[model samples]
Target chain A: MSKHLLIVSTSTVYGKGYLGYMEEEIKNFFGENKNIVFIPYARPGGISHDEYTEIARKKFEELGLSVKGIHEFENPKKAIAEADGFFTGGGNTYVLLKQLYENGLIEPLRNAVENGKPYMGTSAGSNITGLSICTTNDMPIVYPPSFKALQLVPFNINPHYLDPNPDSKHMGETRETRIKEFHFFNDQPVVGIREGSWLEVMGEDVTLCGELSARIFEQGKEPYEVPTGSKIKF
Target chain B: MSKHLLIVSTSTVYGKGYLGYMEEEIKNFFGENKNIVFIPYARPGGISHDEYTEIARKKFEELGLSVKGIHEFENPKKAIAEADGFFTGGGNTYVLLKQLYENGLIEPLRNAVENGKPYMGTSAGSNITGLSICTTNDMPIVYPPSFKALQLVPFNINPHYLDPNPDSKHMGETRETRIKEFHFFNDQPVVGIREGSWLEVMGEDVTLCGELSARIFEQGKEPYEVPTGSKIKF
Candidate 1:
């Protein structure tokens, strides 16, 4: 049993239906894991856990898998230990991480995933699989106990990463600028995954998937782009 | 002696020099308070404290006020206590608040502003005047002891607020969507101030300043627009 994870930048890309862009990848990643537990903690639009879970349930059902919301379980930790696979949807990272900590599911989920239970996450969900949730673009609507996240991966992930629009007059810090600021106080490497991009992790091996290249930022070096299908070294 | 504060959305608007757009307001707010302490902890682009202070020094110099970085003082608490006024420049809000807490300056600075020393903040600076830093747009580059802020105002401030761009195909959450999510967990009212807009706080009066209208979001209610010069009631 080795680690298996599909860390996605977003659940849906522009002009695509929910999880439509990655239907093939989702099918291949989960492979025969029929009983999937959905972690809907990152409730987009501030919807209830049950509502968010239904969205994932329908999508997973289309893939011939049965989905149950983790919130629906009598004991979430016990559910995680018994589930064959997991799918965490996208929403506010602060809310998601906070709920994860409050429910005492961080260690249980981390243990399950590390012990070869397949896990898939998108957006805020994908962000939590990293070293910390510091690079997430979601607002800190709620403060989590700590910024520490399940270190499923060695570095942090910046999901839905966008390049600076040179033509815009907006003065807000661009994604690149934000990551540079993170480097000032942090020493972790961050992978900036664009929409439709994801990281495929199999045991100790992690590779960039989808058609776009990822921008890599290290503490003291210039950010560079790693092409699709390349191993995410560092 | 009243609460004299200038909470601005941005330091530099497009096509304007740093602090140039609000030159008149800055002068009027400070009003003969010649000795000002500068909080440069929010170090934009990871610049050194001295370098960040130099930028503020030159700008305030043009306004006929001498500025010194709070870091230059032997005791930061004492510095805040004695300065006639203060100016905190725009950068990462998390960094600013973290440094403030680490140096034990939150209480002293809050006391100074509450006791009639004129205080001004742009972007991240403006954010600290709010109830909490949970609404800030900056990355959590550094974690502070708490999300609690100066609490100089009853509500939260969303500085450099941008409306949704209808023409864009990007999949990221808009500023409006982000604020809506914030209301899901937090009860504080949020003032979404545009780049050129600011709040003028005088004692118990908190009025919307500048030419643009601000979008106000309260928990469980539809967000609405309040025009310039209007008092931000709730």
Candidate 2:
């Protein structure tokens, strides 16, 4: 039987060590289930699966959760099928997309989700939840010459949102400005997921989670925030 | 023989609209030489060649630089070879990569520069000068599912460096903080190109240009600013 789909967003893991809140969030998804099928192969720029998976194993164990190491699986397709709902740990989302594309796992994951698996995405993982993966914070880790993401959600996800940097010199333009620039070139609504915050979608219902709020920006209007447990509507 | 390569960085364009500056710059490049072959096909991502060329034509005319018209070339490789040195105006650097990659112009353009033909990337154009095209504000307009840019420079570039947004919730995390997130994952230094400032490469020398200063950030240390015309070691 297909399990619930859980996607751990890309930004939730190890961002400058800023993602300290990740374990609690991950546990929320895991709940009573101790064995998490770990996918630590998302780190880009030649990060070995062993490196990220071991890191995840340690972190999950530290959280008192048993980890079923899935990074060892060469074919993510079959591996994905064998697992319950999967947990996508965070890292460079672009790198993750590159892997998904290179390995051709996008369709398989979608199929599994449609088959009724619970999904949780953190940071970059969360980024892939949107309609277009264009809103991620991942530096085009590797240039396939363009940006391509797993379109799980119907909107773009911007992870790790926080207050602006004090020392920044780009006047009137914050990361918000940057995403607005992204919107200017396109017509997609961007979902800005701040640190400690995420949007959880279960069945037809989407709820926001975390300490801060998630902001959604559309054309010719102000960016508004979606409070925790609130459904994001276009 | 080929006249001196005239490249205009996007500092002027992305800001207050610079038809006059662009016209003057073009004049400086092709003084008395009406044989100037114009190319404005580098703005990538579903941006029609006609639309891209139209922007160039309109801007040149508005700035008073007399020009016949922009050459609408779909195949950048053929356009690049048959034409003189190229001029990459700014918009979306990642989008530019899409067009360049689809039309197979990356290697040919690199070869052209290697053979001593002038190549300039303004804004997004200037952005392509770096190792990858992840630097620009252009979101993925289309889904070729790649961001591999023409690595003309050794480091990464951040264009349209605007100041932080005061109302933003991302506290303690300025643009530097956000970019710092990238540093946590990779070892590359991000060059924040403030408006009016640019990095120019001639032969073996890569120098900064413009009236505004730039910020350079690595993983461990605090970010630093590089004055105009300064040569960055990293």
Candidate 3:
């Protein structure tokens, strides 16, 4: 059976508080699994791991679900394997993957999620669920051993994906252009998960969640949008 | 003496043809240096090296200069060493650096620039002139051997640097926040070179050229804007 995963594009939507929009969804998703191990490896804006974990702690506290930071454990690998559920917050994807590899928690985390444990991720966390982090929007502040990430999903995820702004005068490559470039070197499909959108994966049933449609790009195929509630098998 | 380097933030500005806005400046900078070796490894949008080179060739031809792609030569190292001047166009910084390392051209290119050979770069090209490509806006399509760049300048360069759009609904990290995250793991200064801005390095003097001001970011110091034509010693 496939793992139970909720890969959110972003924790906070525009003008929304931290995980505010999905509070009810999160509460329902965790269900009776109150012991959620929080992984805050992707430190956004250079925030300390403890500080980042605190943000998640406060959010889950309101839901009456206890959250423990992965860093609080003596061995992160063991902690991930024994955790009842997992919730990895968003930040810098590169840093997140780097720490995961460093702590040797990649396999343990993968096993935990694959064994039917509840797993939830947002932004950088969702990025790691993909095949690799080549599709991430974060800067490479630190070099990981490799760009390889957890292969929970068959394809890659580009979180917080935005369409090209026609009004903007900037000439930088758009999100579409970047994904196209990724196809040049990689054959994997890329799902452009827009903010406020997410993927709900439960035992081979991968449904697009939220109000917005997600864009999907496959190798040698034209990019197309899939509406919310559509099953994304790939 | 240092080299003659025109590190442009981008090759093309909005509403302008490719390299159109700075044609005159490029012509003046090249002067009588007709034989320009072009490095097209950046390959924007999966464009072939030959195709990218053709674009540069057409532009330089109009400026009364000859251009040759580095890939056309058997020995890319010798090409860099023997060229009168060099021009690396913008594309994907990761791919550009990867190719440089693969072809063993980084050291030779650095030597050529340090030996007073004229060098002009736009976008990804300018990114390589910095100490590292940590502040680049490009997606990491490939894993480079290292993030270490040509190091022509003592600081890192963030080409096509954009300020946060006040009206936009996007909640993604701004250019400033991204650069700040870079500082969390790195200590080198970063120059946010805006669109249309170019840095002219003649010997030890680094003057910010073009019409708009550039933002300078140091680890501990507040990121401040430098007026156009101001010298950036750091």
Candidate with maximal lDDT: 1
When just chain B is superposed on the true chain B, each candidate scores a TM-score of: 0.98, 0.77, 0.98
**lDDT, candidates in the order shown:** 0.93, 0.61, 0.92
Q: Which ranges in model 2 have alpha carbons more than 4 Å from their true place?
A: A1-25, A44-48, A74-78, A143-150, A161-189, A218-223, B1-10, B13-64, B67-86, B100-119, B129-137, B144-195, B203-205, B210-234
Alpha carbon RMSD to native, model 3: 1.0
For candidate 3, the TM-score of chain A alone relative to the native chain A: 0.98
TM-score-based ranking: 1, 3, 2
Q: lDDT tens digits, residues B27-120, model 1?
A: 8888889999999999999999999999999988998999999999999998898899999998999999999999999999999899999989
Better of 1 and 2 by DockQ: 1
Question: What tens digits encode model 2's per-residue C-alpha lDDT throughout B57-97?
Answer: 56655544433223454544566666545566666555566
Model 1 Cα lDDT, one tens digit per residue, A132-160 = 99999988889899999999999999999
Order of candidate numbers by DockQ, starting with the best: 1, 3, 2
Q: Where does candidate 1 clash, by residue pair?
A: none
lDDT of 3 by residue, A48-133 (tens): 98999999999999998999999999988778876889999988998999999998888888988998899999999999999999
* lDDT head-to-head 2 vs 3, winner: 3
Best by DockQ: 1
lDDT of 3: 0.92
What is the DockQ score of candidate 3, to 2 decimals? 0.84
